[model samples]
Target: MNFRIPIFSLLMIGFSQSAFAQIKEEQLILDRKREPEIKKIEKKKTSVEAEKNYPPREKKIEDSLNLRYTVTDVPAASDFKTSTIQGEDISPKFEAENLNNYFQLGMGNFGRILADGNIGTKLENEIEVGADFHVLSTSGLKKEYPWSSKQNIGNVAAYLNANGEKGKFNVIADYGLNDYNLYGIYALQPDADTDLKQRTNRFKVNGYYDFYSNEILNNVRLKTSFLGDHFNAKESQAEIRVNLSKHGVELPVGNDVVLNADLGLNLETLNTDFAILQENSSKFLNATVAPQVTFFNGDSYLMLGSDFSFLNAKNSTANTDQVQENRTYWFPKAELQFAAADEFKFYAGVTGGLQLNSFANLLETNPYLLSDQQLRPTETKYKGYVGLRGDIDQQIKYDFRAGFGKINDMVFFRANDLFDTSVSGNRAAYDYANSFSAVYDNGKVSEVKASVQYFPLANLTLDAEAQFTKYDLENYEHIYNVPLLKAGIGAKYSMLNKKLHLGANAIFSTDLTTNSFEITESGSQPNVFISTENNDDKVGGYADLNLSAEYRVHKNFSIFALGNNLLNSNYQTFKGYKVLGAQILGGVKISF
Candidate 1:
């Protein structure tokens, strides 16, 4: 504003205005150059902070963009070769073996010799055929006794068996021959010569057939046998049976039921040529039908049945007229079983039947039986029994039973009269002092039996059994020659991987009462009365011990030795007959 605007002011003002304009222009250029760098730095800083909060977004794929894809062809399977893989050799360590035939031979004291053989073969049609033979012979102990007691027994059997899809069939034929001397008489004048040679022959044939179908009939069996002796005694028997059974009949109680039926025919005939016997020929015929039904639940079972029998018998005798008997009998049977637990069970039953006692049967039980004795059939009216049988543990099993029954015509053995004044020179009717006669009595019997088996180890077993019976005779004061108590104990042990076996057994029996006579002088006449002072009417009790050992020399061969009556106890199974003492036998067995 000075009138005189100085040259300096003008110049300063102009300089200031120009300098401001230049500064503004320079700032614009610098900002323009660094704008991209500054924006990048800010964008990075924003991205880092966004990433911390959320994941970064994926890039968008647009359809408009052009892309390329490549396809490659698969290789053909035929281009490669296949191969089979091989495995290591694996063979069985044990051999394949079978045992179907065997042979045994033995010798012992008392001049005993034994021989046995078996041979078997299988045919191409799957049928099996076999044959067996056995012989046992013993020389007499005449050095100790006055008579020779020699014996020889031989047996032969042949069998054929066939198994098919439908059933199994078997046929067997057997024959037995026995030669023995009756050496039981010792008091007949000491030098009385008697023809005591005896010979017996037995022949049998049996057939069995079973069906595997679901039909009512299942099996059929047939048996026929003939027995003859040199004493003009002959016996023959024949039997045939058919069985029908069906199972798994459902009941309303959600249980199953089973039914069984059996029909059989039996025929027997016996003829004896004893001069003094009244009856010489006896014949018997029986037809029986038995039907049974069983009902089973989870742990209990009931069995009910009945046996209907029709029996006929005819006897022809010299002293008595010919007699014929006919009878019909019905035997009812019922049994109940319940398992209290897995290892325990209780059972009870009632049973009855008619048993045929032929001369052959009587003689089989007692070979010393007198030939002229009367033979009759036995009738068991009824038998009731209760039993507890089960395993106490895995290794022990026990069974106990008690029964009572009545028997008609029960057979018993009695010693023949030793002294008969009627007969001259101590020669009685029986002629043999050690022989026995069969007697029949109607009696009631009560019996108790118990048995125990223990298998503490796989290779060791022990067993014991005891039986006691009491008889109330209807006609006799006592049951003659019937042991009141009988007991047996046995044990078997195996060692060395079953290569060695040891066995021991003991048998004991109580004393028995029998009738015996003594010779006494009465007014120069010999008198016979029952002995009372010499214990001759009583057979003393005895215990017998038997021991056996077997050692396997090879898989197919074994050696065995047996010692009988090892305790050397003087025992008599039959009165007046002493058993052998301390006898040993050794043998070898070979199997194929």
Candidate 2:
């Protein structure tokens, strides 16, 4: 027990010494942090002690452990502020006005009058229906002649269209009437007025049905027409057509391709009473099949196809048991197109087809035809062509084509008595040699065509085109009424906030061969006639210029003026038919 007390006392002494050492180290750390303040405090103490002359006292444990801290000042922040914002006002929208219905009226010199109008409406389910009418007439011209030069034409049409999902269709019905006096050839009969005045009527119905996303069968077309003149010349026809297309068609040596075919059937009946032709009426039945295949590669495509057709013809007035004429044809429709760039292409192709001719078509080509004219089909044996189509730049585009064609049964217009001038004639209204006759011949034609379109400005467009054709007729002395060169220039411009529109076009045609005949009295009692032919005689070689302008005075009203034959010269359209002087017409147009 005595030994333990000494050991315990010794341990307690060591622990007290360790604790005192730690407290002293903490005081030293405080003195180092504020050494200047501590020195000042010590100096003040010494001064006080010296002034009072008092003895120094020993410092205790509390004095050694005392600590002090300094506090720093911080500035205050300002108040928060924000500005208010206002929203902009929105403009009201108005619905657009309907301008589908329109009308036009005009009057001008040479006793001209024009009137036309149209009205239409949109029905439910994407359907549209409309009707329109047109009328034009001219009354006074060439008073010095014994005959009257008067013309009148009128037309009316109605249409219905429907657009559906993956399919669409349209149907149209129209009628036209044209009345005029054949004053170019004056009649020798005392009452020629009754024979000279004639009228033509035209009626037609056309329809089309199409499928947008169809793969096998895509489109169908139907047409019916009846056209006739006062001279018992009439043509009535009905036709139906369908298009078949298929994609992803498998091939033996290559990938899938596309196949397309077009099938058609047509029937026609015609009638004509001629002074010379023994058979003046006919009937026709035509069937056609066109099939094509398209092979595609990298920027290149080849379309190979052929058109095959069968035609049957018979005399309209003949007995039902009569044998009909049967004809068959095959035409190539092949082309290879290579795209050199995005906007340019080079293509070469061969095409040929048969065109059926009728009195209506002949009348359109030559208005003066004998009623007893024979009708025949024009056969295009072959037409080979090479073409380049591309855009020059952003604003200009161009197309150039050169082709050669061989045609059979090409029709030409010739004077009535051009070949035969026998004194004894039918003495009919058209037998006076003043009328024209249709002549057919086989010929070869080489042609080159070029066209360019330039959009110089946003609202202006300029177009120019030229065509040159060289004809080769074997054994025929002349190719009548065929122009060697044809060209035209047209321009359309809109200005003044797009309220004024101006259009101008000029057409130029080269000289053509025409038959010139002269009549001479060879007898005193019978007044026998002798006709002479001028083989080198020619007609045409004129530039026809026309200009039109329209100014929209209001949203629904416009003022328009047009000047035709602006050169102020006589324009001969046919061999003996000449148009009046420069015609000026002014009118108003309305939109509702």
TM-score of each: 0.77, 0.76
Displacement of residue 325 (Cα, Å) in model 2 is 1.7
| RMSD in order of candidates | 40.6, 39.8
- For residues 247-267, write the lDDT of model 1, one tens digit per residue: 445566544433323333444
Find the 10 residues in a row with the least total lDDT in model 2.
Answer: 80-89
Q: Candidate 2: where are CA atoms >4 Å away?
A: 1-98, 186-195, 248-279, 297-299, 315-323, 418-428
Tens digits of per-residue lDDT for model 2 on 166-236? 56667778887878766555223224353556678988788776665336675677777788777666678
User: Model 2's lDDT to the true fold?
Assistant: 0.59
> Whole-model Cα lDDT per candidate?
0.59, 0.59
For model 2 the local lDDT of residue 295 reads 64
